[model samples]
Target: MRDTLRVQLWPLPTLGVALAVVAGVGLPRLDGRIRHDTPPWLRDYLFGGSADAARSVLAAIAGSMVTVTALTFSLTVVTLQLASSQFSPRLLRTFTADRYVQTTLAVFLATFTYALTVLRTVRTGEDGRTAFVPQVSVTVAFLLTLASLFALVLFLSHLAREIRIETMMSSVHTAAERTVRRLLTQRQDPADGEPAAGDPPAAPPEPPANVLPLTPGASGFLTSVDEAALMKATVEADALVIIDRLPGSSLIAGTPMGAAWPRTGEPFSPAARSLLTEAASEAVRTGPERTDLQDVAFGLRQLTDIAAKALSPGINDPTTAVHALSHSAALLCELARRDLGPRLLRDDDGQVRVILRRPDLQDLLDLAVSQPLRYGAAEPAVLARIAMLLRELAWCSTPDQYPTINAALARLRSTVDAQNFHATEHGRLTELTARVDEAMAGRWTPGRTR
Candidate 1:
């Protein structure tokens, strides 16, 4: 009860006193004829030369005005302070430090002075036998002033609340805009033609026939070729022919003898023999590196799969998928760098050069494919074939030759798409092409002119 009263009394008293004062002074000033027809009894009570009564009346009015004014000001200050606590501390400080409080106080004092003057005039007018009190006008004016002050307080408070809300909304808007911009610009994957960072892993292909039997010689590295004629052609064109000798015979290192060219050839120079030996040794020693590459490729493939799944018709997890894709790409790049070295990794004129003469290119490609497959199943066969083509192009002598490889891969991809064979693989192969293109274009730049 006390608390409720405490809260109510301050505003109530302020209103009452302010009304009384404004009524007393303003009414008579606006109406000049208010001093006539004063009642005899009221005149005697107020001003029939009774100085004590006048002094007592004056003192009562002053005391009431002072008490109400002080209470109102204190309440206003306290309320503002509490409100400030609820809002931003900085705003509260500014509001409190403003001249609003002082202005309110000044208005209150003016009301008190006006009331005193009007009351004194009424008493004096009664003694002089003239009408002084215009009760209706005085009451109306007092009520209007009180109403205005209340309205003003309400208006200001409401305005402050709106400002705060707007500020909060604006901040939220800016943050959202910034996030969208980053996703659109900096984080997108130019290669895959999708937003960056949300790609699924590529699925693994079934293990190919491990034709370890083909290369029986301990020093001869054997890789099966579907086109024996093509393989022979390549060997002949490059002047690095591979000759197949009798299983039990120890052929000279530099002798050129194969199914295509049966007779044993003249021996090579010591340096050439040493180079072949080194190449054979490196190939044999690549077992651990191949395993590592396989692992990395498997991981990449999985990430690509996730990205594809996220982008599927019923799914909507693009952001998550994109993040995975980015991570996988970064890992793949690192692995490539470790195996192939920095020179081969550098993007140069829309082509990724993998100098096959260097021992690490095979390891890098193996790893790249392995990582992708670890996460999911392999892409379509056609796509896989296209990727193989691209990998082969990396062995080309010049960067300009990449376009020919790209065109061939594109045709292969189109054929696979048309056939609807291994749809997922086809899509993955397309994505791989895009990645190669992006890599050739440098970090973020896309659209390979070559």
Candidate 2:
């Protein structure tokens, strides 16, 4: 829900408009009282023009503010277009979630709303009423116009910086790092060959019979699951439920999501099967798009997309791809140090009640490395970064993660072998692969490689 609000452009600006309406209405009434208390010298600061003059001033401000607000919207749309075209479309969330852009829009719209609201209060002595001008209210609108101007300039400068490839990549890296830290826990070393504390025990062997096949209630991207509710249902039915889809996975209606079986190794009665199915439907949420709420691979996917887009023939920007790889390397190494796999939700009695399938190290490696390796094969720089990424992961990975790291290393090596590189380039890559070997063996040798 928070992610949804952050990625939207309306919430902040709507709030600003609401507040502006309140202020625009209430300030004019306050102006009637405050106008009498104004000191003679202070009168110079407040709007002292005639009612007609006040109308013209407010009218001009209102007209110009409307124009400025439209310009801001146009520029924002153009920026979104450029970002989507030049970079990956997934990056649109970053720009939309930006506080600066939202604040700027909020200020501009509030100014326009305030000006129009206050404009209606300007009165001339034509309808048997005394000439009246809310001096303080007019002054406030003028001040808002000035603020809108400054915000416009600052917003333009900010937009310029945001469109740069480096800025967008850094923003993605930071967000992905936050997701990694939040969702994953560091791997704990086992003592005396026992499973570490906080780690779920191995799942029981599959039951020979009485498994109930489950399907999704709706079709869309699986965004989140209500684990607590799912667990409650599992405990009530006395069954073990396994969810086959992760947060970023797509689901089709009436398609198998996973299975549930009675914990007693007996067939599920019709009532139990119906209860579990309803629970699964309500507990699992599908959305039009994926979020980082539970998906660890979403960030890596975005970074990889950026790299792949950079390596496209039309873009042909290998440097950006290499830069993106550097970001991916940091995230992959972080994941390597963390415990990852399917999540087991246990009941109050310590019985494993729910099984949620999640991406493990190998899955993440394939996500972070596969596409870049495919598209960036001919570029020596991109290849070197991929090898360096492997070496970094090797140094940080646990013993159990060695196989996955080694597999990725092999893929990198194969890609390099297929490339028609100069002798010096291939030699440098071969040496990097050797360094990766040393790192995997806990014998990281420090030396310069040419």
Candidate 3:
């Protein structure tokens, strides 16, 4: 939980403040020493440029930088708002996670701070005979002002491009694809191949008779589970542990994080039970919001949310919906080639220690396409794209996977059959359905996939 909290904390502002502090203290002092120690003539030639003029320049730049930084922040907030309204609020994570945006904000704020810090040191000595000018520091601030001006332009350009529908869809697609790959790679049984429909991995046997529930101290989404730590904890308690909630589950106070049962007939000791519970809690990490760390379904949900939002009555943008569906197809295609099984964690001796219910491939496929199709079935483009999506999944996946996609196609066909459509559109959908039906029947070239 501590590690999760650290990652969740926004670091850019802190980084900007640190950079400002370093520049503010270091540059001015260096410049002041050069002014006092350097030969007067050469200093006049270099460090001794007009103290009054440098001070005025630094002050102007400092004030202007403050205004520019404020403007940048305002525009960024507006962009975030527009993205949330137009796409899904879930997508705001992608925008916030953007390094370019964070760095841009950091640069502008840091530059402003640097200018203000050095600007205070530009004053001359009280005596008319002596003038103290940090010429080098003032020059650095002036250059920083120009760089910030350039950054302002870049941020505006980035803001414009980053909010486009294509960009949003692409970002979600990229994240989802990466997540699918990561989930598939972490599977324990490499040679088990993909799971056939109706033949899921056998469930671990029922819990031991004497069981104790372990409740978490905090409430949030379960971000990750340290399986190794959990297995060790189960061993120490001489018990079988079952995690009731999966990684993506939103935790509630007093809810069972999981339950443990003693391996032997003897019940667990209070001290042993307490230590076991503590270890279990430590193995699980929760946070305020869902992340993609061990939650692939969260990424799938993000795509569908955008598609569903686009198909809403207030915003009937079929093109965006179609675009989202297309990427959903891409992610599903990747998922098709991998096994989707509930993970059963075991100890070194091969005894089952933990059972976790992961989201199956079929569940993800439904999430990726269900709501979008329900909202978009009437639109010709969305209907066509969904049909194409089903065909691709049907063709690319294993024969056992065919049944699930075929059932989805059956659902689509039933809905299309019930809803009235224009003659041309109806004819187009009918043809697509025929092709998908053929694919589901295994007519496609074998060993070929996209």
**Model 1, span 1-450: residue lDDT tens:** 231232232444456467657656666675455435556655443333243454455445555556756765666566556434432222332333334444455555555565466556543344666544444334433554474466457545644553452332233223323322332222223375532322222221221222111222243322221223333332332223222332112333333323111112444445544444333322322111111111223333333444444444465444434344444334433332232211111122422211112223343334333333332222343244335434433332124334544554465555545655355555666666565555444333334322
Candidate achieving higher lDDT, 1 or 2: 2
- Kindly list the per-residue Cα lDDT of model 2 for residues 34-129, writing each as its tens digit: 888988998899998899888898888878878888898898899899989888888888889999989998998898888889888878979988
Better candidate number, 1 or 3, judged by TM-score: 3
Order the candidates by TM-score, highest first.
Answer: 2, 3, 1
User: In angstroms, how far off is 421's CA in candidate 1?
Assistant: 46
The number of the candidate with the highest lDDT is: 2
Top TM-score prediction, candidate number: 2
Question: Superposing every Cα of model 3 onto the true structure, what RMSD results?
Answer: 4.1
Candidate 3 regions exceeding 4 Å error are 1-10, 33-48, 127-129, 186-211, 264-267, 445-450
Residue pairs of candidate 2 with colliding backbone atoms: none
RMSD of each: 29.8, 2.6, 4.1
Instruction: Give residue 439's error in model 2 in angstroms.
Output: 0.8
Candidate 1: global Cα-lDDT?
0.39
* lDDT (Cα, 0-100) at 187 in candidate 1: 20
Summing lDDT over every window of 10 consecutive residues in candidate 3, give the lowest-scoring window.
Answer: 1-10
